[model samples]
Target: MVELQAATKLDAVFHALGDATRRHMLRDLAGGERSVGELAAPFEISLAAASKHIKALERAGLVRRTVAGRKHLCRLEARPLEGAHEWLGFYKQFWSGRLDILESLLRQEDAAKSQGEDHD
Candidate 1:
């Protein structure tokens, strides 16, 4: 059995998503369930290479697999990602306040520029 701390789950999710190939795989899985072949169709990599990336995602708990006959179907398991969202929410409020201040400063600058132009 595998378990991740709530605090550390975001780190795991972001680290697994750092790869371009894995990002593409995630986009495809977002549309619906897919087999490894369907997920690998757009890429030029070998099946073995794609499988390695999939394994990383599986370990991170972002993807779940169900084996049927000889095929494995991969589905998105997004509950783990809520940890990432919760982490980001903290920074969002801080940034929005900073951006609001910047917007006011910019407006003042623009008003001063227009006043100077009127004199010219």
Candidate 2:
């Protein structure tokens, strides 16, 4: 089903996002495209390690890469993140509703307690 495939793809996106290094790379790409070397500059990782991270992002559909001769140019492909955001938005709404109910109950209980103290 399409939903299953979307969930599977979202799983890959979350796995890719689970790493701080890949997240930073995505943030860098958000500004515009950059060479693999440019993406790897801030970290102490070897080029190979950076490539592995980029490959993961590519697999998640979070980044697009193009080869220009010997250089690998990478750019953010953020559409997959929109899917992830949509998935999280469902839970956000669910929790927000639950918290709102909890806040109302607490406010009612506090008002009742104050009324009892005033009567005493």
Candidate 3:
């Protein structure tokens, strides 16, 4: 079903994002396109390792790689990230609401303590 495919895609995106190297690669690509060599430059990882990371990113739809003669150029493909962002947004809202309640409770506690001090 369409929902299942979407869930699978979301899983791939998160799996790609789960690695710090891949995340950094995405961040680097955000600035502009770069060759695999350039992406691999910042890390101590071997070229093959970098390729694996890029492959994971490609599978997640986070990066699009194009072959240019001898070099493979990569660029940020951010549309897939929307699903992740939307998913996280839900939690952000839920946490924000929970935090607001916690803040209110803390404020009420402080107020109660102040009142007790005044009575002493």
TM-score of each: 0.84, 0.92, 0.97
**Comparing candidate 1 with candidate 2, which one achieves the higher lDDT?**
2
Selected candidate, larger lDDT, 1 vs 3: 3
Indicate which candidate wins on TM-score. 3
In model 3, the clashing pairs are none
For residue 82, give model 3's deviation from the true position in Å. 0.5
Q: Where does candidate 1 stray beyond 4 Å?
A: 1-4, 114-120
Q: Tell me model 2's lDDT, rounded to 2 decimals.
A: 0.97
User: TM-score for model 2?
Assistant: 0.92
What is the per-residue lDDT of model 1 for residues 1-120, given as tens digits with 9 covering 90 to 100?
Answer: 134575466677888889999989988999999999888889998888888889988977999989899887899988877877787888999999999999999999999999999999
Q: Where is the poorest 10-residue window by lDDT in model 1?
A: 1-10
lDDT of predicted model 3: 0.97
lDDT for each candidate structure: 0.87, 0.97, 0.97
Residue by residue across 2-81, what tens digits does model 2's lDDT show?
A: 98998899999999999999999999999999999999999999999999999999999999999999999999999999
lDDT of 3 at 80: 99
User: How would you encode candidate 3's per-residue C-alpha lDDT over 1-120 as one tens digit per residue?
Assistant: 999999999999999999899999999999999999999999999989999999999999999999989999999999999999999999999999999999999999999999999999
Candidate 3: worst-modelled 10 consecutive residues by lDDT: 17-26
